[model samples]
Target: LQTIKNHLVEDMFASEGFRSDLFYDVQTRQNIVDVVKKNGKLKVNDATMTRCDLLNTNGVIHVINKVLLPDHHIED
Candidate 1:
């Protein structure tokens, strides 16, 4: 799990869409980590999240889990 998280973080930083203010924000990073912990997955499809396809610049993909991840409010 730690490995996956690291990979995601690294990728995010390397991504062109990454914004220093948004991506490096401790609160936002912790929120994403919390979501992964509680739901065993990341809610990549969230409006606030960004996605991109390396193979196809014209397309993008979000990394979502089979199950919905809960937010800080515990809402599903």
Candidate 2:
């Protein structure tokens, strides 16, 4: 879905140093989704990164513990 793909950025966070990136969520009509690294933990809004830097022919993939949906669809 566009919402999920929207969460992905073109940058490789593994070696680039995880500061922050802005993504768009089409489902919520939101223009900015925050992906941040704090205390050595990478978080996509609220989802914590479980596995990271999966190398492939396409690009690197980072696995998160929770689903990255819009705020309205996710519970606090």
What overall lDDT goes with each candidate model?
Answer: 0.33, 0.59
Give per-residue CA lDDT, model 2, range 1-76, as digits (tens): 7567646666555724655442323222333455655667766667788888889887788887876665533222
How displaced is residue 32 in candidate 1, in Å? 11
Q: Give the TM-score of candidate 1.
A: 0.21
Per-residue lDDT tens digits for candidate 1, residues 1-76, read 4334422432322234443323232233224432222222223323233343444354334544333233423334
Runs of candidate 1 with Cα error greater than 4 angstroms are 1-14, 23-58, 64-68, 73-76
TM-score of each: 0.21, 0.62
> What's the residue-level lDDT of 26 in candidate 2?
24
Error of 2 at 50 (Å): 0.4
